[model samples]
Target chain A: MDKQMLRDTSRRISPYIHNTPIFTSHLLDDMTGAKLFFKCENFQKMGAFKMRGAVNAVLQLTKEERERGVVTHSSGNFAQALSLAAKNLDVPAYIVMPNNAPKVKKDAVVGYGGIITACEPNINAREEAAAKIVAKKGATFVHPSNDLNVILGNATVGMELLNAHPNLDMIVAPVGGGGLIAGTALSSHVFGKNCKVIGGEPLVADDAYRSLESGQIETNYSTNTVADGLRTQLGDINFPIIQQYVDHIIRVEEVEIIQAMKLLWERLKIVIEPSSAVAFAAVLKNKDYFKDKRVGIILSGGNVDLETIRFS
Target chain B: MDKQMLRDTSRRISPYIHNTPIFTSHLLDDMTGAKLFFKCENFQKMGAFKMRGAVNAVLQLTKEERERGVVTHSSGNFAQALSLAAKNLDVPAYIVMPNNAPKVKKDAVVGYGGIITACEPNINAREEAAAKIVAKKGATFVHPSNDLNVILGNATVGMELLNAHPNLDMIVAPVGGGGLIAGTALSSHVFGKNCKVIGGEPLVADDAYRSLESGQIETNYSTNTVADGLRTQLGDINFPIIQQYVDHIIRVEEVEIIQAMKLLWERLKIVIEPSSAVAFAAVLKNKDYFKDKRVGIILSGGNVDLETIRFS
Candidate 1:
């Protein structure tokens, strides 16, 4: 996507999403020896950056497509994001969630007006359930992170960060399904003055890191990280953009992820999920390189299950 | 004090404190059926509004008093607040704490340059320890929430809130040692246009509520509340102000406090201490009176032991 397209997508979804605030802490700056600016998407509508992409994707649909409604398979923040986005736009949303998904997640989606269709807790079952909805109900299937429109929408986060602090030396984001970092990299390349983009991945789920090194998409053998959002592999739509613009990937251990998450909660006084802490963990892990530089970290979401948090 | 004094305190502490942002949630507003504005003192420099009073008190100290240093007896956010405030002003801070205070609390004081003197957990022992420090060092004693200068300092919170939202029909603050509510009441009286002030107290530790009815300071026989910060009884210095200016006080159950705290963490995406939640719980408890009116709630602090949090 071009710069104009990113700008247009941001404007299109402006009314539906929040221009999330950037938070800074002197204690954190002293600890890490870097000027850290946290772009808090935790405060975004539906409590995640996914809302930006979801709203833009739905808005880009034609009248007929909008009339047919939308469908997505997710048990994470994207389910709530798409459901709320569709509800706001007066369009129906069908969510395909695994039956094993937490009750809180299912309840949140339903609370946002999403029509749920539960399937087995497997990729094949999820995809099959979503496909059936698209076939029977004439619904538009919207990929959470792989679609071009969704990537363009996520790009607005980086664009807004640069607009607020134009001289940031680097921007770091967690490499989840690769959509957020890819869009961030594209935004930095187009909207910033030499702002480099980096991706933070869980060492256990380092598909994006391996893919970059192998010059092709890679898959994870196991998803055993606390950063649950970063377990998914990269897709073709955003992988090329990430390869072209992303500076490099840094992998952090689960322990480091928890430490960073605790620090953010203690110092910044904001609630953030473990996945969002990966970006900050990467900076702390390699403090020598990031020290003395203005670094921007995207706190992707704050949809943690408070009941099950295990800081130990 | 008056409006000019409140304005002067705001100006004096402006350099040393954060003019913390106000947060709003559509979900919370919808849930309460009122327009709610949260004065986020949880984001204050020391993670509590105590910093505002601490800095102001230290700044107002005479040159001789400052040279001799400052001292206070506390086992909560005030220990860290005074330590950081004194450190910022290049003055020594001596903190007298119960020997049973949490290790994290002691570490925070030390981290902020406060010299700690441990004493028995009883109030008489705390007073004796603090008195010894005063006699030995000839330092100025700064009460955590009972001194005039400190009350003036805390009043800036309400002053700033009024300045931001002039039309607020009422403001709610949790009553602890009574400095915050007394100062908030004064600010609403002086700065607001017919605005009323309310106090939220834990039902188990409802000394402030009882004091208002008895026309004399009252003490809690049992401090069996989860809101640890509000267990202290109202002091003579702030009791008169609270009685004269505060419209009323609302006492909430411990379960209500936890529920409100959860809503803030889940919806507003901010970490607030249980004491802060008392005010929001008060608003929720009396929704009929507050409905359709503009209400402001002061989020008192964010200093919870993450390791020991038991939501159930």
Candidate 2:
């Protein structure tokens, strides 16, 4: 995507995105000896940063595309984001959520006036369902990761973070389908290469971790992280961007992600799901690099099944 | 406290406070015809608005007081807030919690490097335990509610709400020891009075509601509200302020508070304790006053026992 297009998209969507609070994490700083700034996108509308891309994608659709409606396959935040975004645009959002998806997420999407079609548990079935819907209705398909506008919209978060706290020495974010990391890395790199952009991955599902290392999209592994939001394999478009723009990638364990989630909840009083906590887990594991430095970490989202989380 | 002092304190604490997310409930709006802007203080630093008061109180203390350290008797949010704020300021925090207090609360206090002493569950026992600590350590006693700086700090939330959405026709807040409502009322009144400030009380712990009617601090009653934060009798200092500034006190049943808590979770995707959700319960109960007008509701805190909240 063109840099001018992304910049213009950032301007268009700046007013809509919550310049979510950036809190100085005292407990984290004491724990890691790093002056950390946390950009809490968990507090973003729809309980995730995906709303930025969803709104941008929907709002930019042609009148014919809007008339035809919109469809996407998402297991978590993107479903709710698209639903909420569609509500704002007064357009129909057709979401194909996994039948086994969290009921809370399903309810949130439906609550936002998005009609949902429950598909099979696997990614392939989900895509098949979404593809059939798009074909039947002739509606615009807003791929959660592949879309240009969606990536541009998420890039605004990185832009906003750098704008809010320009003294950042390093930045880290949780990576899933690579949409967040790709957008975040591109935005951060464009802002300045001096600002290190590291991607956080769950050791349980290190698809993106391997993808970046191999310099090609790798979708061989079955996901295992408690971060349901981070389960998807890297999308085709997101892989190249992330491979190019992102610096080092760190994979944290399931327990580490849970520990991070609990720590943020206890210390920062912010409820973040396992996926979002992956970034914090990275900082905790890699204390040497961040010690006594200004670091920015994106708290990606705070949507989790507490009951399931407690068990895990 | 003087009106000007309150404003000064709000200004002092502005940098520390999170301009928390506002969740306008479509369900609650439908239930109550009035549009409600829920000022989510539950998302505050220590999972409650108590942190505002605690930070303000700890920050305002003289260097001599800091040398002596700070102490408080609390089994809830106040304990966590005091511990966190004191730790942030490098001051020792001594907490006297009841033996029956939740493990989570106790863990949170200890996690923040606060010294904890256990006592029997009662107001008399709490004071007695704290008295022993004060006599031994000479720490400055920080009353959870009956303090100036704490109240003023809590007032900043009102200032922020008004700043974010200026045309609020009414502001509803939960009344525990009354620090939050007192500050909220004072700030909203001082900033502008076109908006009425209302307090929500649990029907079981209706002392504040009764005190307002009788123009005096009401006598002891066997209280049994799920709203643990509102179980305390209104403090002497908070009574006068609430009496002068509050428009009306609306009391809600325990079940309604729980119901509101559940609904808010299902819709808002935010974790809030029963006390914080009580104000929304009031709005849901009193739909007539809020129809078509913009109402401001404070989500006081979210430091509830997650197990208790989740199962219930």
CAPRI classification of candidate 1: medium
Candidate 1 local lDDT, B136-225, one digit each (tens): 999999999999988989999999999999999999999999989988998999999889999999999988899999999889988988
* Each prediction's TM-score versus the true structure: 0.98, 0.84
- Candidate 1, residue A283: the lDDT equals 98
Candidate 2: list runs displaced more than 4 Å.
A90-92, A98-107, A115-124, A305-312, B8-31, B40-48, B51-72, B79-120, B128-142, B147-167, B183-195, B212-216, B240-245, B262-271, B304-312
**What range of 10 consecutive residues in model 1 chain A has the weakest lDDT sum?**
A303-312
- Supply the DockQ value of model 2: 0.28
Model 2 error, position B239 (Å): 3.5
The digit string of per-residue lDDT tens for model 2 on B1-312 reads 456786677667666667677777566677778888888887788778888898899888889889889999998888988998898889999999999987877988998788999999988999998998889888989999878778888888888888888888889999888898998888888775588899889988898889988999995486677888888878888888899989999989988998888777655756788888899899888887778989999988877655454533
Best by lDDT: 1
Q: In model 1, how many backbone clashes occur? A: 0
Clashing residue pairs for model 1: none
What is the lDDT of every predicted structure here? 0.93, 0.83
